[model samples]
Target chain A: EPEVTQTPSHQVTQMGQEVILRCVPISNHLYFYWYRQILGQKVEFLVSFYNNEISEKSEIFDDQFSVERPDGSNFTLKIRSTKLEDSAMYFCASGTTNTGELFFGEGSRLTVL
Target chain B: TQLLEQSPQFLSIQEGENLTVYCNSSSVFSSLQWYRQEPGEGPVLLVTVVTGGEVKKLKRLTFQFGDARKDSSLHITAAQPGDTGLYLCAGAGTNFGNEKLTFGTGTRLTIIP
Candidate 1:
C-alpha cells in the first residue's frame, strides 16, 4: 500500500539554525498536514495544506514555521530559527478524502541543540 | 478547545490478555478516530467512528464512539506482541472534518510475550 514517507529520519541542528523536514505523502492525496510530538506529550497539529495553500494552523505553528509543497510530491516544513522547544518528532500525514482517515509517515526526529 | 484525554498513561499486559484504552473529553466531537504509533514512527490509523454510538472493528480490535460523541474507546482481545504501541484518539468538528485533527496525550500499551 502507498504510504507517507519522510526523509532524514533524524535531524540535529543548533539553536538559531534553519532546518527543513521533508515528507512525500501518498500519491493522489489531496490534503497534507504537519504535526509534532514533544517527548511524552500529545501530538500537536502544526498546519494543514490543501489547494496549494494553508487551510489552518495552530498556535504552536508560529512565525518560525512554514510549509510548502515545493513540487507535486514533496511537502516540507521549514523552521527558520530553531529553539530548544522546537525539538520534537515531526510527522507528516495525508488523506485522500475529507473523512480524515490520515496515513502518517514514520516521523523525523528533530533535535534542536 | 477540544481535548481528548487518554487514561492509564501506561499499561502492561501478558500475551492472550484483553485490554481497553479509554479516550474521553468534555467537548463534543463530530467524529472520532483511533491511531497506533510505534516508537520512532508516526501514528497509523486504526479505526474511525462517525456517528453517536457507532462501533468499528479491525481484526481483534474494537472501537466505539460514545453516545454524546465526547468519548471513545479501543478494546483489544487476546492481544499479541504486535498490538503493543502508543494509542491515540483524535476528535474533530464534523462539519470541518478533514480540516484538522486534535489529538490526545496517548496511552502506551505493552503486551508482554
Candidate 2:
C-alpha cells in the first residue's frame, strides 16, 4: 500500500532557531494536512492544504508556522522560531477523497531546548 | 470550537475480552474516523463512518456511528494482544471542501496475554 513519507524522523533544535519538516504525500492525494501532538496530549490540527494553498488553519497555526507545496509531491512545514512549548510530534497526512479517511506519515519528533 | 471527548482514557484487559471505546461531541460531523497508533509511529486509519447510525465491521472490530452524527463507538470482540495501541477518533465538519479533522483525546488500550 502507498503511504505518506516524512523526512527527519527526529529533530532537536535550540530555541529561536528555524526548523523545517518535510513530507511527501501519496501521489494521487488531493488534500494534505499537518497535525501535532504534545506529550500526553491529544492530537491537534494545524493546517490543511489543497490546490497548493492552505484551505484552513487552527489557532495553533500562528504566523510563525507556514506550509508550502513547493512541488507536486513535496509538502513542507516551517517554523520560524521554535519555542520550548513547540516540542511535539508533528504528523503529515493526505487523503484522496473528501471522506476524511487520511493516511499519516510516521511523524517527525521535534525537540526544542 | 468543536471538541471530541473520549471515555476511559486508558484500558487494560486480558486477551479475548470484549471492550468498547467511545467518542462523543456536541457538534455534528459529516464523518468520523477511527485510527490506531503505536509508539513512535503515526496514526493508521482503521475505519471511517459517514452516515448516521451506520455500522461497519472489520474482522473482529465493529464501528458504529450515532444517529445524531455526534458520537461513535468501537467495539472489539475476542481482542488479542495485537490490539494494544492508542486509538483516536476524528471528526470532519460539514463545510464544503474542508478537510481539517478534529481529533479526540484518545484511548490507550493494552491487551494482556
Candidate 3:
C-alpha cells in the first residue's frame, strides 16, 4: 500500500536555528496535515493544508511555524527559529478527502539543544 | 476545543488475555478512528467508525462507536505479544471544514508472553 514518507528521521539543531521537516504525502491525497507529540503527551494538531493553502492551524502553529507545498509531491514545515519546547515527534498525514481516513508518515524526531 | 480522554493510560496483560480501551469526549463527532503505534513508528490506522452504534471487527480486534457519537471502544480478544503498542483514538467533526482530528492521550498496552 502507498504510504506517506518523511525525510530526516531524526534531527538535532541548536536553539534559535532554523529547521525544516519534509514530507511526501500519498500521491492522490488532497488533504494534508501536521501534528506533533511531546515525549509523553498526546498528539496535537498543528495545521492542515489543501489547495496549497493553510486551512486551519492551532495556537501551537504560531508565527515561527510555516508550511509549504513547494512542489506537487513535497509538503514541508519550517520553524524559523527552534526553541527547546519545539523538540518533539512531528508527523505528517494525508487523506483523500476532508473526512476520509488519514494515513501517516513514520515521523521526524526534532531535538533542539 | 474538543478533547478525547482515553482510560487506563497503561495496561500490561499476559498473552492470550482480553482487554478494552476506551475514548470518551463531551463533543460529538462525525467519525471516530483508531490507530496503533509501535515504538519509533508513526500511528497506523486500524479502523474508522462513521455512524453512531457502528461496530467493525478486524480479525481479533473489534471497534465500537457509541450511540451518541461521543465515545468509542476498542476490544482485543486473545491478544498476543504482537498486539502490544500505543493505541490512540481520534475524532473528526462534520462541521470542521478542514476535518482535523482531535487525538486522545493514548493507551500503552504491553502484552507479556
A3-105: candidate 1 lDDT, tens digit per residue? 9999889999999999999999999899999999999888999999998999899999999999999888899999999999999999999986668678899
TM-score of each: 0.95, 0.98, 0.97
CAPRI-style docking class of model 1 based on DockQ: medium
Query: Which parts of model 3 have CA positions greater than 4 angstroms off?
Result: none
Fnat, model by model in order, equals 0.75, 0.75, 0.58
lDDT of 3 by residue, A11-76 (tens): 999999999999999998899999998898888999999998998899999999999999789999
Candidate 1 positional error at A13, Å: 0.8
Give the per-residue lDDT of model 2 (tens digit) for A1-113.
Answer: 89999999999999999999999999988999999999889889999998888989999999999999986889999999999999999999998665768899999999999
lDDT of 2 by residue, B19-103 (tens): 9999999999999999999998999999999999999999999999999999999999999999999999999888633668889
In model 2, pairs of residues that clash are none
Between prediction 1 and prediction 3, which has the larger DockQ? 1
**Model 2 off-target regions past 4 Å?**
none
